[model samples]
Target: MKVLIAMDSFKGSLSSKQGSEAIAAGIKEVYPSADTKMLPLADGGEGTVEALVEATKGTLFTVPVIGPLQEKIEATYGVLGDHRTVVIEVAAACGLPLIREEQRNPLIATTFGVGELINDAIERGYRDFIIGLGGSATNDGGVGMLQALGFQFQDRHGKEIELGGQSLKDIRRIDAENVSPALSEAQFNVACDVTNPLYGETGAAYIFGPQKGATPEMVEELDQGLRNFARIASEDLGKDIQNPPGAGAAGGLGAAFIGFLQGELKSGIELILESVKMEEQIKGVDIVVTGEGKLDGQTSMGKTASGVAQLAKKMGVPAIALAGSITEEAADLNEIGITSYFSILTKPMTLNEAIDPDTARQNLQVTTAQLFRLIKAFKQ
Candidate 1:
């Protein structure tokens, strides 16, 4: 029998590759001679580069860039399949993790490092780019990113605007003439999960700013900032960028790329699955296993497991999802071809203890073994 193991990072616990391996281990125990394929998955977010690196034979490059608060950090991106495609995770330098609990402040955060990473790739003659936009710590609507790519944002008084989301309120002039001409020569795909528009009640600021350390006033301010930027982009750049689906991602960085860079916004799961040729590998596989760190209402929304199940349904394959925790809404997944769901935690345990990932992995392996035995019995 053949089996495919695909999974997303068990965030704070195990990586996507590790999760897939554990699932494969369990199935192989039941059919020791089974053919197993492991594919690590990410939704164009935090573990994107790592997932792609683990799945594809690829090399990673590190470049020095400015962090969220202007600190120096070495952000890494990947060259996949003979360096023809570049994979980048925006969170490496400017993500929320770079900011401490005490220092979380969307008003002052920036995405400059993300731009620098792209610029570095451009300099290396990479014209095809895959950008995963997740785990951002800013609400600057990509102004910080634009700045790094040679676009200037100036106040009405003709002064250069200062950095951070707070500065967007200053009446502004946008200058894009010096912007990297190389961008036009390249193709960019943004891996994103959210479908929120650029501005409104469901927009970037109101929905995501709070987690990035924004207060009520800051969310209001940042939302206005994104709207203002979109106004200019529509009028000056001839692009109607605001309110585009997924434009609220990465704190309005989605709008920034969609407007300024003309990047393509695509679901992270779709892009990753296509890039890795996951569908081709799943053909004729007896069973497929996919999982993530958590399963909840949000999991159905362009998540790794959801993507896999959708594909499995298309291929007429039975699939199972394993997670650290399975929420009530996960039941909807069964309709998409996920046969069942499993939670790795065996007993009531603390988050840390439940996430004692090695134990959880072993449990998943054992569970799969039993599940396979049941399948064999039924077939007999």
Candidate 2:
């Protein structure tokens, strides 16, 4: 039998490539002669850089850039095998992980480093860009990033506003003439998975601020700042950025790309799958396995596993999802082409213990071996 193993990262425990190898090992043990293909998958979030880079034989470049808190740090982005297309994830430079739990203040965090990464790429003459917006630690509506790219945000007195989410409220003038002219020569494909608008109840601040260390008062302030920025973007820049689907992604960084760079927002999974040419590889596969660290109802909403299952269904192949934990809500995935779901854990254990690389590999192998045996019995 030919089995295709496509799995997302198990997060802190295992990477997508590691998970696929474990799954493949299990199937191999059950059927020594079985043909297996391993494909690592990600939904254009944290692991997007590694996933696309390896899958496309792309080259990764590291550059020094400012972190979320204005600290200097080394960040990485990739040039796909096509050489013309560059893939970047905002998380590399300004993600939440860069800040400690106590230091997680959205009001002060900035996306300036993200802009530096883009500027570095532009300096190299790369025009086509795939920017993944996720795991942000800021609610600045991307003003800091704009500032880094030569756009100036000033107060009513024409003084340059300081960088940070809180600084958005002081913006009264936006000077884009000094902005990088290279931007006009560029095209950005923004990989986003959420659909929250720019402001209001379900907006960036209200929905994501708490986790970014915002208090109730800060959330209100941040929301107002986003609203103010949106109004200015529409009136001054001639671009309506408010309340657009996905405008709230990455703490309103999505709006910045759409409003300033004229970027096209797309589903994260679709972009990743296309970049890897998954459609061309799914041919002639008997069974396909795909998954992530966790499987829940959200998995059906354009996540890596669901995206793989959708493609497998089109090819008339069954797709199975394996995860560290499978929630009851994951049943929703059944209607979306995932044939079945399984948890790698076989016996009860603490979350930390279960996620260890060695333990995870053993559990996955055992589960896969048993599953294959069941399939053989059914066929016989």
| lDDT tens readout by residue for model 1, 225-297 | 8888788777666877776788899998888878778889898889999888888978989888888889998
User: Which candidate has the top score in TM-score?
Assistant: 2
Worst 10 residues of 1 by lDDT: 234-243
CA error at residue 146 for candidate 1, angstroms: 1.1
Tell me, by lDDT, which candidate is best: 2
Off by over 4 Å in 1: none
Clashes of 2: 0
Q: Estimate each model's TM-score.
A: 0.94, 0.95
lDDT of 1 at 365: 82
Query: Scored by Cα lDDT, where does model 1 land?
Result: 0.86
